[model samples]
Target: MHFEQANRATGRLVTTGEVGASGASDSELTTGRFDGQDGHGGEDGHGGKGGQGGQGGQDGRGDQPWFELWNVQQGLWLQHQLGESRADSNLPLWQHLHETLDLAAFRKAVSFLVDRHQALRLSFQDTADGPRQRVLPVHDLDVPLVDLTGLADPEAEVDRLIRIESATPFDDLGSPPVRVKIYRLASDHHCVFVNVHHIIADGTSMGILLRELLLCHRAFAAGEEPPLAPLPKTFEAFVQDRQQWLSGTQSKSMETYWLDQLAAPLPRLRIGDYEAPADDVVNETLEFWVEADITEGLGALAKELHVTLHILLLSAFVVALRDISSDDDIVVCVPFFGRDTKDLDGMVGNFVNPLSVRMKMSGSDAFDDVVRRARSASIGSYANSRYPFTRLLEQVDAEARPGRNPVFSSAFQFTRFLPPAKQTSQLDLCLYGRPDGERIKLRFNYNSRRLAESEIREVQSCFQAVLRRILGDAAISLDSLSEPLRQARRTMRAAPRDGRRLGRLRGSRSTTPDA
Candidate 1:
């Protein structure tokens, strides 16, 4: 099988392959003399030339504008324990890379994906009739993987590379119908990464791209040109489809839901006791992990309750708010994969939709009943999630509430992505010396003004305790979740808050924590 990767340091395509089965161990190949600027003529049989530029459409009208989906998570960014390295070199994982190496086949697959999904290859056009979408055609995207080997300090080099990428900024403003980046990292091995701004592809589409790229690379490795499937419809078709849907009754219902949710303006969190300059805003992150067993227990509880994992998590979040904010009503931000269609899976684009989940924590509401409410609200939001969050914010005339973010504050995410399978032959594949840091995969930004690490942890601990209780007693209602939070408040009264700055809240009393 053959695999094609973009070499960032040297903007060139590098191809590598091996004669092996579906799952073979990767053995390192000896490096010959590094003479040629273009990585070619290697004994391991890895080399490729850049393809011709794709023909842009006639009359500037043919090329579509660029678009991006932004999930602005609010609150204090969750910080991690830095500089603590663990030695876990997860190597020798292999996938069908032979087919994904061919440039032609890769482009064909990308086009197929974009043509079938609106979230991929969508552009916003400023026309006389206001901003509109001018969907562009998907062209060949050649990602060159560089081998950043023998660096004095590879981590420094990687950080330098990331800074350079950030400088160019993804051009979310105008032009460059797509934001493309060639990233370099040394995770258990030196490797190059690519993040095709969702304006061009989504997470699921990435899966499609990888699968097709493998097929294409395999065919190329075997010295045979493979024919790829044609796309059924262009992104424009999706735009047209969405417009029709928006003008219908569904749009009205979505607008109504959003308006009602925000009727009570969001409350701003009071930052930590420390005072800041007039124009400065304080930002902080607190990160903690829930072990594998805990995750499994949560999943099991969800299964037993016949509710989605999302609902269970949401209920926990509500309980947290009750403990920390002393508020009965709470709103948490939830991100949804906007690609509801099966055919859009392989398309690369941004389709993240944010939904505001508002729930009322009543004295008598049972835990099971709260889960049911959150679940129903979440599923219903998905049905009309196509409404861009920016649009919804504007329609509701809601001002950005003070705090970390203008709109939403809290976020929830669950990831299950395994690393890319590696080839057995070292000559065909290379592993980095260090492991990849997976802690920052999903981040939450919170306001230190109102909530501190202590408060957040106390709330989280309460939720954990409540979840454990529910695991033992499935019939226990939502009111029962309060015991832990109540216990937390009692403990806090005796223990000093960690970062008690000058102007911070000495403490606030809410409904007494009841058993």
Candidate 2:
């Protein structure tokens, strides 16, 4: 409930501006005025001030030797190389504000931020002992403003620009891996786009950065200094803390837990009909909003069952996947937020860590049974949240084949995450759920190499149908759900791969058409 979000009159990338795109669907991209706090954030959500003089993050360049990267960081870094070379792991965030211009204030606020967070000035290098990272001194910030109000189609131009910017890679060595551009559609209307590499930030970092930017802009607009509190801890300090934690006993315990959880030959995801691509496949996204009725019932069920909404949704996802695969063992990769302590609450870095959650299913299992299994798996993973998935992969003796993941290929998360930008992923499928008031917004991204468009449509149809039934009555048997999924799979197997919509893959279940 205390999640950080953008204030009213704010929107992210390509969500249809006020100019000439009135006919566009809101579901094309994530656009809404998320509620938030004043002047950065507080202890309740975004990190608050506690440690004083932790300037190590802001001006700690060349002060000491380079530090080791977090296990996940190293994994992402290597993933960029070992595979068909990812274009760039960039996360784009944007906001639309209808207000008068104050360019001076905006620039100052950004400069103040550059001087405050060390991540804004990070540089990586391949050292003798592998890759190491260090914070560099504050450099020039790329805050450019473009006036598009004179264009015939300002909104359409904005959309095109977003796609181009999302595909562009960052120069991590020459300057900071961030670009802030202001698109002016009118005198009182503007769109702020900020693109940062995932190495330095995650979904949570967007909220923190936006809060700081707004707080600084407000203060400077009123002809006053920014009143943002000093960060309790710097990103560098958090990295150092993790270094020591990795060598401690708690870290060892988490490793043992993971080692036991994923023992022996791991299961590979085989839902898609096409063969896994030799290289990174062309990724595509299918986003839709769950029905208001289903959303209401799911919340009620969660409350009745004494579990969080995340557990409920994740349970439904597990059941849907299980029905399609008809496999007894289910492994879904779920990433957990890594802001474990207050010291890390405000720091902006790659703090999202992944957990390879495995669930065992039986034919006689009911909806409630799967919920309990999901709850247990979730709680256990949360307890051992520090264990890195990359480390687990190294310890697990799974086949190292290209294309499909040797371990779990499907991933699921119930968090405010970045929209699909690169259109490429190491995994075959990913489901992201973000809570929006009474309804839940879902984004399903799939690899074309592993799954055809029609096949993924079947997967989505199956999930919604099974979810509606589960919410209606938890006592329904899982054995009853497989017939629909199995039939859909058969239909997909027989359908031509000429790229046509597989409308109504399931027998009478309503499916949200491609957005």
Candidate 3:
């Protein structure tokens, strides 16, 4: 049976898969010879101006195609080259299928997906104009199938494969940014590993790719041609649109707003302080889930406050940071998926823009008042979110700080779209979620060099405490609540092993607030 679910962002019912259809069997899907080189010029049919032909300027290589880089892409590319230490941008999407699968149909489905999305076929090349993306023509990209079914330790081998794949950097100058591999543990169990560079895809792009890939797989397995929709806009078209928008009046106004908003010296969260300089900085994440009940309460509270759930959570986070840092000014880097236009919704590429949100919190303010302040700040930031972070930095004349990001040291994001996982007729497919679960996944990506894991945990605990207290009584003064809450915790611990106190303890423990 085909299952349909409403896309949280778009509210459109998306078809997960179709039950059965007849045309050609899975084995027959791969019968045709795939001539890797036989494809049309890279830019023939896509929207926007077709791909530029000749390489120009001293920076361009004669053999590679060149296209302009978006501001965010340029920033990331420069950081990858100039930063003393590099964090690998290669991201792996791993899935374990618990049923016997036809490799032929799977490969065909992946090829179909690659052909459909223009961004998947792109690589970056350094040019006189900075880094430019080059799009490759459709080819029979190889999906390596490794058989580990006979290995002495299959589990260890699986881990080894994952480690190697995750650590391997993508050859952005030469090869396409995506790699695929399949490992067979037994006739009925297999694991699929797909690694792609962050430059070419984001979480939303991955979801789009997985959904279409699964649809194609089911169609091919059931002896029918895949019924996937043509992309509404090409990645190149989106890039062109973005460039035009950035040069327009609206972008200038937005840029001005950011310059003023961030004019004050950026406030650093009191998570930790690392003075020594490190060549490379690696980020560590703390993963946790907010239970359905608390999540529901948050949603209700968001409605009552006339703000988004994200805004409410961010308000509590600001209060928590204030409590820890004792600094009234708190700035957080919040990620915005820069897909405001409907045309760019399904197109794959790096569309994430991290914008700084500055919120002023006072200990004496009421919880509701702080939430309103956060809401206003959030609304203003989001209204002008399309301005590129790199351009904003230049506009503000902000100097890069040693061992830290310039404007904001901390980041926050709440994602509703988890990784796509589904079951088909012959395969029990499972695409790994962010932290792998149904409840909202809150990932706190922090600089390991600056902030200790213990400090992050403390921040998490403080956020939870503040959120619960506010929910219990939104009218409470922020200053009065903190001490009383500490005292309440002490009283609860001292009261006894009675049911009432035990219930209170359970409530306290359940509030695993997102960072």
TM-score of each: 0.62, 0.80, 0.74
Question: Using lDDT as the measure, what is the rank order of every candidate, best first?
Answer: 2, 3, 1
Where does the lowest 10-residue lDDT sum fall in candidate 2?
8-17
Q: Each candidate's lDDT (Cα)?
A: 0.42, 0.65, 0.58
lDDT for model 1, on a 0 to 1 scale? 0.42
Q: Provide the clash count, candidate 3.
A: 5
- Deviation (Å) of 187 in candidate 2: 3.2
> Which residue runs does candidate 1 get wrong by more than 4 Å?
1-168, 171-192, 225-228, 265-300, 397-399, 402-407, 415-451, 474-483, 489-515
Could you tell which candidate, 2 or 3, scores higher by lDDT? 2
C-alpha lDDT of residue 470 in model 1: 64
Per-residue lDDT tens digits for candidate 2, residues 390-509, read 666778778777655666778776755434434456677888788877788987878886677777776777788777778667878877666655664555444655553333222221
lDDT tens readout by residue for model 3, 167-237:
68764434677888889999998887777766677656766766776678778888887775445556765
Question: How far off is residue 106 in model 1, in Å?
Answer: 7.4
Better of 1 and 2 by lDDT: 2
List runs of model 3 lying over 4 Å from the truth.
1-65, 82-87, 152-156, 274-282, 285-299, 397-399, 417-444, 482-515
Q: What lDDT does candidate 1 reach at residue 200?
A: 40
Q: On lDDT, who's better, 1 or 3?
A: 3
At residue 495, candidate 3 shows an lDDT of 34
Tens-place lDDT per residue, model 1, 359-390, is 76665677777777776555544444555565
Model 2 regions more than 4 Å off: 1-57, 60-64, 79-88, 149-153, 172-174, 416-418, 421-423, 435-439, 484-515
